[model samples]
Target: MAAALDIKGLKVSYGNIQALRGVDLTVEEGEIVTLIGANGAGKSTLMNTVAGLVRTREGAIHHYEEDITGMDTRELVKRGIILAPEGRQIFPDLSVKDNLLMGGYLRSDKENDETMKTVFELFPILEERQNQMGLTLSGGEQQMLAIGRALMAGPKLLLLDEPSLGLAPIIVSNLFKLIKRIRDMGVTILLVEQNARIALKTADRAYVLESGRIVAADRADVLLKSDLIEKSYLGKS
Candidate 1:
């Protein structure tokens, strides 16, 4: 089977600064692949490039077998490549339902109502506060809104950037569980997370990025047990 997403020799830069350097990564269908790195390590840059929010300096990006390099965000979303960006970029003024509806703006399908129901099922709190303004929700709720909004697009491959950034520990735990549930629902995931320990525990495969390059790639469990990983990212001595 073809991989859900394939990227080869990907290079990205911003004027004088290089963000990603010859990055090669793939996310197979129905699997959770996590990318872990410190701040400014090009993790977000990779995500943006795949989502067509950032232009690449060189290399190729493909979804399934089709070349999607430089494709616009709307085109990518229509093709089931949806991004729930970092910082939970939900529209503050819109109601929760409206925010979700915005995610499906490109769809003319009749099943949008059904998709909204599915998102409500996945996040019961969203159902309870469907009429509430996006800015009124708590941090965790806003994050849920972000992911639910992405699901509203009927994603085949979900690109999640830092889903656990500022939540309490218990909330983060629950969020990872929900992420696993999402994977079980058959959506392939490409995650970029700063919380390496939890990310490795939740993901099936992992990649380590440092200074804009991939330094290690392995099964998530393997990386979790690695001394180097433990020492550097996991905060273990």
Candidate 2:
């Protein structure tokens, strides 16, 4: 089968700085493929570029054999490409329900309602706080809302950027479990995370990025046992 997402020789630059240098990766269907690296690894840049939020200066992005490089974000959304984004970019002023509804804005009222019900089932707290303002939610709740909202778009391939960034360790654990559940729902995932240990634990395969280039790519379990990975990312010897 063709890969769910594929990038070849992808390059992105910000003025004089190159964020991605000939990075190549592939996410097979129904797999959670994670990109893990340190602060300047360009993990977020790669996700944004894939989502069409940033322009690529070179290479191509293909989704299930479709060339979608440089496509507009709106069109990408319509094509079942959704990015939950970093920072849980929820609308501060909108109600939890409304914020989720915004995610399905491209769909009809009936479709949105059905998807909203599914999201509610996935995150019952969202239903409990349906009328509450987004700004009033806790950080973990906000993160759940962000993922729930992205599900509202009915994504075929989900792009999650730093989902475990600011949460407590316990919350991070639960979030990784939720991520696996999301993948089991038949949506392929391409995750970008700075939490290397957890990221490896959650993914089927992993890629290590350094200075915007791919340095290692292997099965997550194999990478987890690597001495070099332990010293650099896992903080273990």
Candidate 3:
């Protein structure tokens, strides 16, 4: 069977600067995979390239055996691949519920309502604040809304970028748990995080990216205990 998401020798550039240099990745169905590294490691670039937000300078991105290298973000979402970007990108003026509905922009099917029900179950706070504008929510709440919105689309694969960024440690912990719960629900995930410990802990598999290249890839548990974190992940070193 084909992997949920696959990238072969990918490379991306901006003007004359190369943001990703021959990067590669894969996430099997139902697995939570993470790419961990310090800032400027090309994690976001890879995510955007795969999500169809940025054009790839080189390489092919395949989703379920189908080539989707240069597909647009809207089309990718319709195909069951959705990305909740680095910063919470919810529309500040829209009601919490509306933001989620927009995530289902490509769907004409009534299953979207079911997906919204699941999102509410996953983040009860979002349900409570359903009528409130996105900007009024706290940073943590906004992040939840972003994830919930993505969930609203009933994605087969989720591309998450720094979901823990700027949130309190307690909230971050909860977010990580939610990620695990989502994976258990049968959605494959490609997570990019600045918080390696939590990211690796929640993920089934982990990869380390540096200057647009992959330096390590392994089962998550092994990565947590490895020398790579001690030396590379500044905080633990």
Candidate 4:
């Protein structure tokens, strides 16, 4: 079977600085794959490149065996590759429902309503605050709104960048639970997270990035026990 997402020899740069260097990775269908790295390690660059937000200097990205490298963001969305970007990026002026609706703008009203029902099921809090403006929600609530909005797009593959950023520990825990639920619901996930321990625990597979290259790839559980991973990312001596 074709992998849900695949990248080969991926390279990205910003003017004089290269963000990703010959990165190769794959996420099988219905799997949760996490990319863990420190600050400026090109995790977000990989996510953005996959989502078509950043142009690649060299590499190929494929979705279900189809070449989609450098595709337009809207085209990628239409193909069921959706990105819930970093920082939640919710529209402060829009109501919770409106923010979600914006995510489904590509679909018909009927389709959006149907997808919204699923999103509400995954995030009941969003249903409770459907009429509230985005800025009124707490950090955790905003994060839920962001993921909920992405679900509103009926994603086949979800690219989540730093979903746990700025959330309390309990909320991060809950968020990972929801992420697992999302994977169970058959959405392939490519996650970029700074919280290595939690991310490794949640993912089926893990990739460690340093200075724009993958230094290690393994099962999440294995990486969690790795001494190098423990010392560098997991804060274990």
Across 122-217, the per-residue lDDT of candidate 4 in tens digits comes to 899999999999999999999999999999898999999999999999999999999999999889999999999999999999999999999999
Candidate 3 lDDT, tens digit per residue, 157-178?
9999999999999999999999
Order of all candidates by lDDT, from best down to worst? 4, 1, 2, 3
Candidate 2 vs 4: which has more lDDT = 4
Candidate 4 accuracy as lDDT? 0.95
Model 1 Cα shift for residue 220 (angstroms) = 0.3
Regions of candidate 3 where Cα sits further than 4 Å from its true position:
none
Which 10 residues in a row give candidate 2 its minimum summed lDDT?
A: 228-237
Q: Could you tell me every candidate's TM-score relative to the true structure?
A: 0.98, 0.98, 0.97, 0.98
Off by over 4 Å in 2: none
lDDT of each: 0.95, 0.93, 0.90, 0.95
How many clashes in each structure? 0, 0, 0, 0
Which candidate model has the greater lDDT, 1 or 2? 1
- Which residue pairs show backbone clashes in model 4? none
160 in model 4: Cα distance from truth in Å?
0.4
Q: Write the per-residue lDDT of candidate 1 for residues 1-237, one digit (tens) a residue.
A: 778999999999999899999999999999999999999999999999999999999999989889999999989998999999999999999999999999988876576798998889889999999999999999999999999999989899999999998999999999999999999998999999999999999999999999999999999999999987998898843
**Model 2 C-alpha lDDT per residue in residues 137-221, reported as the tens digit of each score:** 9999999999999999989999999998789999999889989988998999999888888999999999999999999999999
Distance from true location, Cα of 203 in model 4, Å: 0.6
